[model samples]
Target: ALLGQQETNLSDGSQQRVTQLLKTAEPGGLYGAAGDLSDALPYRDRPGGLRAIAQVHDRYILAEQPDGLCLIEQHIAHERVLYERLNDRWQLVPLTTPVVLEGLNEKQLEQFERLGLAPEEFGPNRWAIRQAPEPLRDRDDLPDALLELSLGGNLDTAQVAIACRTAIRNGTPLDLATLQTLLDDWQRTRNPRTCPHGRPICLTLSESSLARFFRRSWVVGKSHGI
Candidate 1:
């Protein structure tokens, strides 16, 4: 099988290390094998299995798995993780310093109310938000990505919007430890492939595919499952 062109080509030496990693990469069971694992994931026998290599364009995380390599869009992956967290425990709490929204149309105002933002009119064209969903608190952008979801008029819009805003942006830099933690949370999400807004979050290049691409004889079977 051919890996997507977007798949990063790692060194054969890295591939060899991944082969060694397969011996330790635990299966992703009901919860997750790496859920409580520490950040020291680059070592040969560390838990969680995926060996994070480096960032691709500061947007995607490149990790060596037992298969081959997995490129994960950090922002969308975090969105899925946050969305599930919010869906499981949606909570509204008062902001330490209230957020104020200005120039909100009636629809925007109504949407805030519906989402339990507790917006109160402070003055003309301004509403002070005393309380908001914990996921949305301190967020600079209101979940403005909700146009399509709101048109559907479903409650799921709330979680999706907040998750998108709270999630790590594509350009953010993440260390290996942080990358491993993010992957851990991402693995535990109900849907790991797509974010709440329906964007793909993960991509994989199987070891077999990499071998074929490199036109080399590859052996050893292990799954550093991501």
Candidate 2:
């Protein structure tokens, strides 16, 4: 049975309002919004085989490839890069100003020490960071990073927390140069398809995929299957 509502209608006023809202809304992840990127593509000989073009919603990077356009989630891509580096070995760096964390229970504190993180309890339910993993030491959100360390016991989880804390967040503004540097680093990583949390770092919209969306003759054929 067709149980769901068959259709819904929007009043003229409602439709107008929706249109205005959409116009103001940021383009979240349109990889090929500029369209037909057969020219000005980069990194044709690079390892990842993607040429970054622009950033959308400050969270995803748009790249051009031979097949079509690619959209890369910025935060997750950086996380995967960091995770692979951390898994290889520990690299600790001292913090200029120690970070403090609160609200952790006994088990959580033990977990940090087990992972070789230097945390000293100050007042009740409070701890101060003496040193941090090299990748995370310079992060602005060091306190939040300490909390991430307490998430699990094994080295893998530790890497996850550190990577999450250090990577760039949404709403960040980056120029073309910075985006290129980021793409270069991402390509250097051994695994670029998925993050440590198993989230997709990149997505591709191939030429055939775009053709199908537009109902082009190249894909649908002149006869339309007769």
Give the number of the best model, judged by TM-score.
Answer: 2
TM-score of each: 0.66, 0.67
lDDT per prediction?
Answer: 0.66, 0.71
Candidate 2 backbone collisions, by pair: none
- Distance from true location, Cα of 191 in model 2, Å: 1.7
Residues 81-105, candidate 1, lDDT per residue (tens digit)?
8889888898888878776666778
Instruction: Please give the distance, in angstroms, between residue 119's alpha carbon in candidate 2 and its true position after superposition.
Output: 4.1
Candidate 1: how many backbone clashes? 2
Q: Which candidate achieves the best lDDT against the true structure?
A: 2
TM for candidate 2 is 0.67
Which portions of model 1 show Cα errors greater than 4 Å? 1-47, 140-153, 217-226
The lowest-lDDT stretch of 10 consecutive residues in candidate 2 is 1-10
